[model samples]
Target: MRKSLISATAIMLFAAVIQSCNRKAETPMVHPDFETSYWIDIDLAEHPVRGYWRQVESLDPEEVSDSAGIANASRLLAEQYGANKLYVVYHRQFELDDARRIFIHWKTEGERNGLEIVPTVVLECYSEPSAMNFSDSTICDFASWCVENVNADEFGIYDVYIRQDEGSPQDTQMGILREAIGDKLVRIGLQPGEDLNSYCRSGVEDTWTAECQGLDNELWANPDSVDGTDLYGRKLLASWVAERADSAQSRRIVWNMIPVAWDYDKPVDDRGYVCPGDDALINDPPILGRIAKCHECIVEGYTDGMLTEKFGGYSCDLHILQANSAGHPDSISFYRQLRNGEPYTGYFASAMNQVSDLYKEIATFKQAKSKK
Candidate 1:
């Protein structure tokens, strides 16, 4: 009788342990606290993988072909696992500072998924004039920038890919550009295949360049090699953005500054003028105006503000404004506006007053002197 009782107790304990293990195993892992939208940075060549994950299935059983379907499906999976927002930094190619800015953005807005470096396939898209830029290895104009700025410590390891979604081009290699970025990528259900070895065999010989160091100049200059435009350099914007989120003492805010001219037929305000007036007027008519119409305006075009205005609210996850001569910045005022996702439409100088106070409150003791 004694032996039987002991045996029964042991059996019960074993069953309990098994049940606990099963429950844990069944519990989904990733959490979803961050935003649900993702900005994909795929090259034109990786269509197979993109299609597999983004297309193919209807994320919602009821909805047919809504754009948010895949995002919703991914969100559901994340909820089951315990994850947050699904913001993606989609750069066919980006520089070091840009990657850092992206990291800073991740820190501010989304659940940190650590850093993922994985093998991927992508499709390449380019204009007719740039046919010479494509090759089996990588694009030409962007290569030097990649060689200079790509960093293992900052961006992490990734298996690069060339996508071929549209019909293959005459130059087959033009459709592919393969390299690895970082490591945390998993073969989620919507992905293409599972063979990790399919990527580059030897892997990245190096990530960062010894020549690339300073945060001041190179930080914002979008590689001049790719496009001749001044719009690519991301320095000041990245700095302000990074400080807003990463600084523990600081508050984050959203500032929406659209030109009165954007609503052309509508009455113009006393804010600012339309930039390159004719060009912007033709492209985005409603957003352009003359300096005579609005005297107090700051920067003229959409480039004037931190966050990009979309159809409804701002597109960027976070927002910020510049400082003033009085050593003020609009951190708090903007924070208040965004506390409940409110819209901010104020004068640049006045807004700077709010930003100045917020900056002082959030700025570290070390930076306090800078304000003075």
Candidate 2:
């Protein structure tokens, strides 16, 4: 009887171990994408000095010199945006290899927000060429579903389509798009008979096509032409294209095109296109409007460089800078000044306040228990 009891106990322990392993396998650990890590590092760095010079003796020399302050500040910023907790949950519950499955999971999470328990979530996914075939109708179906389900008022989807093929013919490539998406195609920056390949070519420095040039001119002439409605229309089409092109099997090519729109009452001019400074356009024109406007903007690629420079200042609250990555160091310096309660005016001041308000809202959301 003692030997039988010992055998039974051993069997039970073995079964429990197997079950634990199976659970872990079912939910593989996840980690932040490469771009997320890069941005996090940038956020943790000391604010570079810019504009004014002031000399103040440190009361606690050790505290002043400690690098952890920067990291802590970054953590606080992430927490305010809910990105930190979002990433934590994502890392524990999902894996990156399965792009389609991950995207569906993200959309489902967004839907859960309708119940008012889950915070409205944006899922940004990176796909390899192997997992995508731009000619597949199934991918288009998936994109259409996502677009239909996306509650623009609450949930958002940011997908980064990575392509590997270097030099494919314009029509040939675009033909696949037309075939896959059918009537869903919404052309932007391209005129009838003009192929996307002719305008934007890979491996070329002067890659901007004639259509791109035309769009730039039109935007400069009339900022309202690229307003919110126009931008969102373009984004919806782009999302479909991205979904069709993204595959886990492809290699070497990646395209990130983010379309954004601004709604403002102030007049915009060429100066508005430049990064805000003392020399920036007068009245500051709110730079890019408010953070809420930015929330509505389509985020393409690894960052918002295109939207910030060519289009205008990005009102995206999550981004610390209004300009491209190149200007981040300078922007960080300005941000630090604003944080220290230094005097600011124009668009810069307005943007800072908007971010503050957004942070507060997220904090409130975090504290509230979900109905679910």
Best by lDDT: 2
Q: Which ranges in model 1 have alpha carbons more than 4 Å from their true place?
A: 1-11, 17-113, 117-123, 126-372
Q: Model 2 segments beyond 4 Å from truth?
A: 1-38, 42-66, 78-289, 294-349, 362-372
Q: Could you tell me every candidate's TM-score relative to the true structure?
A: 0.23, 0.28
RMSD of each: 24.7, 21.7
Q: Candidate 2 clash total?
A: 19
Measured with C-alpha atoms, the lDDT of residue 294 in candidate 1 is: 16
Candidate 2 global CA lDDT score: 0.28
lDDT of each: 0.26, 0.28
Q: Candidate 1 on 273-372: residue-level lDDT in tens?
A: 2122222222121112221111111112223221222111111111112111111233333223322333433333332223223222222322333443
Determine which window of 10 residues in candidate 2 has minimal summed lDDT. 202-211
